[model samples]
Target: MKNIKVKTLGAVLAVLAIANSHANETAEEQGEGMLFRSLFGDTLERTYGITVSGLLDIGFSRNNRSTSDERDDGLSNLPITGLSDEGLELGSLHLFVDKPLKANAIPRVTPLPGPKPETADFGFTIEALYGRNAQFSRTYGWDMGWDMNEEDNAKAKRDRLSFMSVPNLAATAYLPYGPGFTIMAGVFGPIIGYEIPPNIRLAPNPFASRTYAFVSNLTTVSGVLVGTRIMDGPHGLLGIELGIAQGWSNMRDNNDDKALLGALRWRTPDMNTWIDYEFMVGNQENESTRDIQAPTSRLISADGQLRQQHSLNGWHRFSEHWLLGMELVYGHQDGDGKPTTVDIVTGPGFDGAHWWGANAVVTYQIRPDLSFSVRGEHFSDPDGFTLFPTTTARGDFNAITAGFRYDLNHNVSIRPELRYDWFDAIEHDRPFGNGRDRTQLTATVQALVYF
Candidate 1:
């Protein structure tokens, strides 16, 4: 009887070992997954063959200006961006997915036969951001719905210092006919400037802070842009794009009239040098105050803000480790407005406003993972308009930025920047140091990690 009990125990142990082996085999067949995938869903890339990327940015900055300079509740110190009075905060966060395109070769797979003369390809980008930088990135209509009315999380309240914005959600289609034309629809960043936006990972800009000239850029546009290559050869490839948008930086139309925008681009076949001339023109102003009864001057003035801009920018890589880039912008708004902030001047002038600016940058690549960059910019806004929306006291805004880009690895980078801003041509009031000082100096260090 004891021998029979021992045999039974041995048989049970062998059966349990076989069951464990089968369980291991099943787990292997299911593919590798994160330890927490059982709780949270699997990653899109691992489950659906899609590509995903994300970035987290944080920084701390100290400006010469005092905390007394802050305005509008708990956020924003004029002329000082990226590193506002609220330092040591999340600067920007981005998570996106994209499939980029090749303009000329996307249609190469199409056969030349009578019936098979059509092959096509497409791509898309969906990007979103959250942090203090969203203040400058909000697209009207979409984000405006929440931001305009000063909803719960719209403004940078004292309790909540961060906000969110969707800068891009666009798609592109490449056609097979006639050297391959492309059509892009939805919201995208303005195609005029060399500087970067809150979407830092998508751009090669080396600066962590913004230049005064950046105020002239229109931020985002919602509409359709169509393009086709005009020339292709050893000299270069020239292309032209034409678009009609609701207006500058707006996902929803501000007026019934539409804005016309277009660009002409030229570059070397090797892409060593590139140049672009871009323009936008249309009426851009609020129409919510339109008086249906008698024609109010306020309504007429709001409709009269016909806005236009022209931008020319280019870059050339002169050497393996050195490059230079420049951008010039001009803008005009044909309407009347008033200054909300006043210091010394009794009467502010706002008959018409025309603004212009220029930016120049030099970069030296010190190593595969490090670079040094310097940029100088000057912008003039005689009567406000694009410089400061609520104030007609804008002036000749000048700034210089010096910074370094150091990458610790493929997914991590750090930037330390020093910036100085001064108003050479004072309009009505001083903008820094609680309306006391003429210049502002800021220093910042930031880190970025990617996933």
Candidate 2:
């Protein structure tokens, strides 16, 4: 408790300091300083060239089916984190500061964010969140005081629906060689999918409700990553990114195992179409898993087996009013299957686990401030590894969602969505409605107030 208090206090003080970082400068000298004064009053971006933004998301959701039992509430949206519940709750209070490193050597068709380009050689980004969405993104070794432990559970915080989490914090350095190299070190965003992490980005959420595929994808990592633009001519823009990290979501390396991560990207010169292939290969097992693994457990010894994930995602701007995007993900983990959220690790069963999923989305812009989107996805967790790690829950979940985004203004937007889910159970009789029903229907509406 003391540690959490200290961390909270420190964060508050840091934000206060950064808020007043350039207060000494006059509003006249900074054009944006005057513009934003009516809003946030000279934020870091206006004076010191640091981008600061925040979001408050509040919403309500209704699930047509749910369990009456308290052990697990089907309305809580098990196996789903972002919209993981069926009631009106404070989704998240998000804040972030970003100083982007400019790709000085060449200009690209795609747009980057910032008031103006800073030709400086170094930059950094730090993002944090407090609310119901923190449970899944919190890293094992990294979330220290912010994580849900015995004490938190005692308070009946079992939904894992409320807390504080830091998803990404890293410093970037630009090199002058070739098209220019961008080197970054620290915790980095999820690289295995097209959807931006809820905690990593402040605005322009792809959709109010997360897809089945994305929820089962990967999360953050503590590591060092490098990237460079290899092509900037008329043919198009091409780039490559590579990195090394403490396996999966591990914030601090718990063993000798490490993961290799990278991506290959290409985009049309017109910026109308793009695609990327991403991959992460390494061992994943925290101390808890190691302590309770069976004699045959791969991670029990130094020779931990590799956990591999691959993602292929792309999108095309079909026209001024139309766009389409898609993603496919496949991964597997090798283990003795004795792990279940550390400390309480128990039985041993399967030798390996595999999961795969695919999704596609289409969006139409009826106007600038209002748009409509529809998505359909199918995800399978036959081995029960990714979706239900603590129990023998194995199945395939298929869902379709349709939603609309209406921006009342530049700072606030409302999103209403309808989603339908059906399950093909492999281990249990059903996946929803207390494991008695195979289908679940839900409706949700959320509003994002940005500052």
Candidate 3:
């Protein structure tokens, strides 16, 4: 896998050069005004800080079908035929660390104790994620008339190796009474060094299977989250927040299933806003009644499931240059034994399907180290067709992306990107026969660092 992603990116740049050489010898014996008041802090001992981040991505692409068939049954079945060339690519590598513990560093130049009230803090976040191509079946494509082949569909090839570690410990308690309130809690876990393929949406072509030992077996996911907030001043200067989460999967086989998530946010001092929701229930494997041809339907058994997801996002800055954003997502699935017809012609049986999407973005700084951006997205197909008829139908698809950014300082950053995709489907089966469409172009470059 590209020499194990270049020896895990040279061991994360040798641990970020030993944490920037111990933060530059602790900022030359704490000069620079007590090292910027101990990494940014001052009024009455409010001290807490830590940050380390990473991202590196590279890309190129062009397509139309048959590089041995890359599936996309709708949006006009287009799989860019046989190896159209481009070059070097690897994306998704993230490393994170963030810390803070109760803060309050003087300011108020004389507002008496009138406002200095809101308090409560605790924090932790540690993360590592690596991705190459990172599935979605190389951006959708797959079907091969069932009996799945190509080495069991090369587990949707996107060049593999998957590892993710997530740890977060949190706390927030500020509301010694009044307007600026707070109450938050946390717990997180997502340790998976390998074994991924619990059906990343039945890969037909999810970015060509991207590593993780070509999917499945080796798993761990643990969780707990809680939250509450209402701040506007007394240190927070802004307000609104809410959160919830519960999770478990193979945490020693507690019936092997569970999940739920919720979120909401709004902040101001500068600007911030947000919203989120999620739900999931699990158990899988049925592959259209295991292709029922009898023989006890090839020894039937394995297909217990229920899944759901909903998402919405928004961010606006309106100044300090400009920024605006939006996103919406919906999903669903339900399955449990008996209910065939190859599961309603492959839309996956007993009725229930949904998909809705929307996204828009605009950002501009032009200075402060340059910046620019644009984004768009649309997708639909929560069952408007395709429950078999030789499979492949569920909303035509549309996509667009653009970018530019540079900030070699204040942490670090670099970005260059372009993307375009299109698909449509009504019917013409034979792996999406006649009714097909194509259009693809991709280019990417990214680098980010923060500490």
Candidate 4:
């Protein structure tokens, strides 16, 4: 009887082992998803909100002129200014805090009924940046004409390398008043150019270089902007925006005159194409302001001046691996014996000073981790106003850049680029460096790490 009992138990054990084997086989047939889930969380359902982000960028460049002084001081863009002509440089250290508004719903039917309807939402963002790039991020709109000491302190801080600029210290609200309106107020970039300076988290390429057009156009403003979607469907989305604020690049009102800003944004259905039209018009400088200092240069005026700018930009993706972007811009400023920011020259008055430019960029993704890009641009600043070469007038400038981005991983990338610059001379002169050449060449390598 004891032996019989032992045999039955053995049979039961064998049956259970076989069933376990079948279950393992079934799991394998399901593409090892069960094992994957056991190790990593679901990609689609991973939740994220209220995030903190940062970027660290470093680069080295060799300019053809080989002069560390880099004579083209005011002509180059921020961070890439005169200080970065040679050797290794810290590009930018940017940090961002984003708290986007969450969607909430209200009960459609009150007494034990159906779905809930969402109401208007609100959110805010703050950006803190350091390094050479901080110079361009200054905002003057917060100057309330209250305390002179405080204003001086703020100005001093802005000049330092550890500059604190709340570039995006703004509030946003989504009001269902009309066809879904969005109102934003604070300091924001002027929506007039295609080459947007990248914050820490949004750098699209490995190399952190910019076109000449971006360096010359409008940069930032402080004020209120209202926008609404005109059309949104499978075909695409169209939007129009209007804004009023302090004149270009001023945190404080240089004058009582206000600037007007407008934009039209459109995106294709598949989200591969975009077109933008933007403009700004108003008095830019107030020389009569009592607290402000007198104009020290021809580009800055003590007298109030009027300026208007317009830009049209378009971007299209031909495939998963190829893309193209283009921009056209025209701007005019009434120079009142003072040089405008766009053109800082010392000479006769600039009553009808005008500037225009065009830019195009092409990108090809060689692989998921490697990509290449080329950018071409041309800008014209007539009257020897903006593109004033050293002791000469070089009204027209052209540049071309080629670069490649290689991603080390999700958090790190390396970029190498080469650039060539040429000029159309109204007067024979060298504008790029202390060297006596109408053209310049440069090479750079950069690394970006994100957290």
Candidate 5:
């Protein structure tokens, strides 16, 4: 408790100091400073050329099929972190700051230059977050002040008051070699996925809630990433990134092995259409299973085993008011049967499991302040590798969602959504309600305020 208080105080002090760093600069001289002030607080000004923004999200949801507890919400087949089936929930509160890059900050070299281009500038971003969504975004090794000797359950430990979390704390530096080649280090999310992370650039959220594949396969990566543009043109653009990280959903290195991360991002000529290809190879372990492994259990290899994942996401705008988004993801984990004891380290008997899924969303803008969207998805977890296991076998889940966004004003918006999920019964009986139901329905409404 003392440490938490100290940390909180330190954070508050840091915010104040950073917020006041540019006290001497006027809005005109600050450039991007004025833009941020207009959106954030009236006093919110750029400090050292860094801009600041924030968001607050609150939501209410109910699951019609949940019978476990009337008061407690249930989200069958959905990511456990976003669960809010039967009550109001504080989704997240986020504050982010980033230094704007300047065109002439770093020198750029061209093979045959008609005119030498200006240098690239250095930039960095830091995001401080709180609430249930923040907790769900926690990376491994981030201590929640839990007593390991008394309890090892991740969920149970999180039930305490450790709600604050830092999901993005990265710094970026551009190189002088070529056109703005840059390296980013620290805790940052992957450059994949169609769903926008909460509290990012001011944009309309495509949906009021999240999807299973979004939470299960797409998580944050910790380490360093190097990125540079392959082609930059008014008609089209291409970029590539490569990096090495601790591992999936991990904040600290758990072993000697490091994960490989790579991505390719492309945008069409108009910049309204874009696509991304992302891949990762590494090792991951379910801390719960490994903690209780008996010494006599067959010696498992260091870092456990191999886990690989791939994803492709794209989006396009058909007109001023209509747009579409799509995503495809596949993930696999290797767990040889010989090491029976270590097989369930990540999940129930998922020694060798694979999962694949696809989802599509369509959005229609009725007016400048009103919009609607619909999403449908299907995922297959053969051997229950990527999803919460029920009955230790392969299972399939299908889900559909519909939602609409109504902007109350420039700084506030309201969203309401309905979702349905169902699972296969042949592979395993009821997967929800303590294995009592095969389908679930849910409804949710949320509000977002930007600053």
Candidate 6:
């Protein structure tokens, strides 16, 4: 807790320093800064030039189940469970720095006669982030049929207050094609998480002689991203970005991942409606098997396991005060070829499934700086992907959320939101006991200040 407070104070100080630097710049310098300011908006203008920005997101909610169940298991088949009663979760605190190729250097005004133009725009950026959340569990209590004693429960509760920090660093190069088009390429180092590595082996016998053990394994990732934007005419605009990364740990053999995304904005003379689509694909090697008899059992291979998602959203403005929007999302995961494990066991073929959902939202502008919105979403699993061994039937879930946002100033905004979620069943037979359904009420107060 003390460490978090200190980090929060550092972030606040960074913001103030950036503001002071911009205030002291001369008019000519400000005019040159306007180009970047207009391109990245207010948020990027303040932080992109400096090297640090901080964010704090604290939320509270009430749930019928324990908080531990809310953790995302990375398995789409797992039945979603557990929620918090009331607590604070830090969303992110980001510190980034940009390094330009030329420092305080002036470009030549006149080009060589009959010579092709030569210009170079290259830079690099490094970023660090901190995020926190509460973990909870449901099986340790007497109500869940567990025979655990009081001491075990207390130990588990103590473990739930842990936090995680992630640091990311990347380098970028900008290539200009003309007045309004440029291609950007970047490579980022691993996003190191301050927790136990995801995949590791724990031997059963302590004194057993080890013939083959891979000890130098570490959790790391590397990725490349490219983005392009065109501002040709006044009628519309187009933008696209793609990224690919490879995992450096032993979770899978020959493991490499990929992601692709694109967006387009179009507006008529009146500028009333717009549409967007986003997609992502990731592949990871599944659980591995080793033979005890063969010293050469550590063979490298690809498991052909992957997860894919796609989302499309559209919005239309009827007037200055009202807007309507709809969104569709689909996701699928193909478990490894090995027969899925019940408790650290593996066997053959695809063992998982897919799910999809649709949602709609309505927004009303109550004032120039305030807006109210309501949203509804429904989700279901198809092909009956199983997470827990007790059941094979996947149920449906739905949620409704309403919220309002108040802009305190141009760079800061506050949002208060309320949400209700319902699940069809805990499993197939455990449908929330009686007709009374599984429900959760969540309230969140978020403050956002950019740059």
Best by TM-score: 2
For residues 1-451, write the lDDT of model 6, one tens digit per residue. 4475568657655664463355354332322223235435657544444333333333333334333433221111112221121344343434445554321111100001121223645666554443332111111111112232223333433333333323234555544444222222333322111111211111111110100010111122345555444332355534444555443311122434443332343333344664555554565343344411011112122455565556565667899899777666666656644544211223245565676666677888889878888877676644433222212335666777787777554444566766666667545433221223465455556554444
What does the lDDT come to for candidate 1?
A: 0.64
Per-residue CA lDDT of model 2 for 47-86, tens digit only, reads 5668766666667877767654433432355544456666
Candidate 6 worst ten-residue window by lDDT: 205-214
Deviation in Å, model 1, residue 210 alpha carbon: 1.0
lDDT of each: 0.64, 0.65, 0.38, 0.59, 0.61, 0.40
Give per-residue CA lDDT, model 1, range 1-451, as digits (tens).
2364246336534433443343355443221221123324446645543445556666777777756435333334455665554456567667676665545521111111112125676787777887667666776667744643244432444443556788888887777687557778888875556665753554656776765556666678899887767677777767777888888777666457788888888778777787888888887655553321110011233344577889888889998999899999898766454552111222333345689999899999888778999999888877655655323356777889899988764445789999888886554567776577768788888877554
TM-score, per-candidate, Cα-based: 0.78, 0.81, 0.26, 0.75, 0.79, 0.58
Candidate 4: Cα lDDT at 282: 88
**What is the full ranking by TM-score, best candidate first?**
2, 5, 1, 4, 6, 3
Query: Candidate 3's error at 63, in angstroms?
Result: 11
Clashes of each: 0, 2, 53, 7, 4, 4
List the RMSD of every prediction in angstroms: 12.9, 6.5, 21.1, 15.6, 6.9, 14.1
Residues 1-451, model 4: lDDT tens digits: 2364246346534433443354355533321122223334445223534445555566677776644344223223222332243555555556666555432211100011112224777766667665545555565555222242133433432332223455666776667655566677887665467765553434333245675556555666778888766666776767778889787666676566888998888777676788888888887654543444212113345556777888888888899899888999888767655343223344335565678899888999899878899988888876544332222344787888899888664455788898887878776655656536677787788876554
Best by lDDT: 2
lDDT at residue 127 of model 3 (Cα atoms): 46
Candidate 5, 1-451: lDDT as tens digits:
3376357546644443443344234422332233357346444333467677666676787766555454343333233235343565556667778774443221111112122235655777777777556545566665232243223334422342336666677787766566556677888776555565663334324666666566555456688988766676665777777899887656655456788988887777676787888888876553444442211111244446677888888888999999898999888877655444255334233447688889898999899889899999887776554654223335777889898988664455788888887887545556655466777777888876654
Off by over 4 Å in 6: 1-51, 64-85, 96-120, 123-126, 133-168, 178-222, 247-273, 287-302, 335-349, 383-393, 409-412, 426-437, 449-451
Q: Judge candidate 3 against the unseen true structure and give its global Cα lDDT, from 0 to 1.
A: 0.38
Error of 4 at 54 (Å): 0.6
The alpha-carbon lDDT assigned to residue 274 of candidate 1 equals 79
Candidate ranking under lDDT, highest first, comes to: 2, 1, 5, 4, 6, 3
